[model samples]
Target: MNLSLFDQFMSPTMMGIPLILLAMSIPLLLFPTPTNRWLNNRLTTLQTWFLSVFTKQLMLPLNIKGHKWALSLASLMVFLITMNLLGLLPYTFTPTTQLSMNLGLAVPFWLATVLIGLRNQPTAALGHLLPEGTPTLLIPILIIIETISLFIRPLALGVRLTANLTAGHLLIQLISTAVFVLLPLMPVTAIFTAMVLFLLTLLEIAVAMIQAYVFILLLSLYLQENT
Candidate 1:
């Protein structure tokens, strides 16, 4: 019998190759491609419309330099949303649930934004470490604290995504297992539990989408600060 509840989070392999790569690629395939014709299919049209609206909203606060990231950020947003939703399916693995995977994504983007700030406006970027009108005695302590907070951004990004996804999945699993075990012993209680599980599943679906959005949103906010 499988004793560990965390086994489901393990990366699966096939023929000595990891399936996480396959899972990541699957979302790209699901996107509808644009046609050469002036008029496109409903699906393609809908996709275009959604993307335009999302891009507009996301880039609203950004300046011209920051707008350059519109396509990259929007693409990442879709990719993440698709992956998170796909992982909700039974028997599918969520790469985002892995702390390492989340960190891999968070660190590079976070670093890029920081670098942009440092390169474009060195004074402004370093100025963030110590605010204006600070007392002389507390200046050093505040700078140290601010520096620590600045470095913590990427770690916060990764942990937030990983912890939210992991918790949701674990809760679903525990509730599902309870449903199965209680069905034979207490049919009434099991029915109520199953109903709760159904509601939780819907909530998880929303969580998956929201977490993806939150991840990108925070990155954009960080970019906004630097740009």
Candidate 2:
């Protein structure tokens, strides 16, 4: 019934309707909803604590102007981490694994940062393209290189998230298939393989969290230069 291992990454469809929206919505539901009360319960307390810590650490380096982005950046971080960790579950889709989706998320925010820099400090932004003490021979080359790197930021963000998630999913699938095939003929080997798979799964979970952190951290860094 299966065609290729990569098929796991394909968007699921039924009756010609893609379920990507449905998939993307699932993680939102998993998040705990807060209540308006003076005294919060344990779960809400824990969630609040975690978010406070994360946001504080994330925004510590930014200035007052950049502090305006705290809420947006925090929400983005939560959404990304949830999507990633949820995708690691069996039979769940990873929206972040799609390069199109990742790019959609990347480009707008990145462009916004650039536009902010252009609006607030155009001279500094343009100045970044040319160094103060550049040789005549290398000016053209340096400008071209800087231009290319500036344009590459969004592409890099999208590709980094996609490749990391895709690779982890593929590896887990491959090892799982190998374990299933070997179980009957080689029980000992299969058991060892399963142990390895267990460890890898743990590693993948960390990677899921780390990639989300790194993605937003890079965005914050970009925002830093502009703000």
Candidate 3:
């Protein structure tokens, strides 16, 4: 069987990032000024809470750079999230579900934090990576563990987003097909299928918001800690 166009687009890593970039860049290009400070404020609050959670209940940065960075990041995050949710519609592809696409979006921020730490405070960066407050004998173990965990953040972020979208889409497809198959035998099954599709559509909306929040929260936490 020939693969559909949807499958081809969904398979590409480069497919999703451009859409997200376009979604993000449009507003910035159209409205250069901060016409709506409400969004900015909301994003800042999210960043604060997110950082606090990851930093063992420690305070997070509310500095200019932090807010500015979050503002920029939030725009991208919103776009990616919208695109992901939109894909749940009939005949649409979820781009973030691709490893290449999510990694492209995630790695830049991950590397940016690294650069920020290295440029501003090399010692802190080293400490952040190697860590301290461990027994001498456990230092090596801690280093290996922390290093693996640190590197895995971006991979985990990408995989989680991709996997969630993939699973959701697959469920929708499977449920629809199952309903279609059983519809010939039972009309009530068709009705139930329709209900499921409706419910799943709503759930997809929540999934979009949740995926966006998770991605942004993790990114903010990473930046807050590294910087």
Write the residue-wise lDDT of candidate 3 on 6-90 in tens digits: 3634432364444544433443443234344555555556655654463432224544455557556656765676677656666
Q: Highest TM-score: which candidate?
A: 1
Residue pairs with backbone atoms closer than 3 Å in model 2 (clashes): none
lDDT of 1 by residue, 17-99 (tens): 88998988999999888889999999999999988999999999989899999998999899988988988899999989989
State the TM-score for model 3.
0.73
Angstrom error of the Cα, residue 70, model 3: value is 2.8
lDDT of each: 0.92, 0.92, 0.70
* Candidate 3 ranges with C-alpha deviation above 4 Å: 1-61
What overall lDDT, based on C-alpha atoms, would model 2 receive against the true structure?
0.92
Count steric clashes of candidate 1. 0
* Candidate closer to the true structure by lDDT (higher is better), 1 or 2: 1
Show how many residue pairs clash in every candidate, following the order shown. Answer: 0, 0, 0
lDDT of 1 at 38: 92
Model 3 accuracy (lDDT, Cα): 0.70
CA RMSD, predictions in order: 1.3, 1.4, 6.4
Could you estimate the TM-score for every candidate? 0.97, 0.96, 0.73
lDDT comparing candidate 1 with the true structure: 0.92
Of the candidates numbered 2 and 3, which has the greater TM-score value? 2
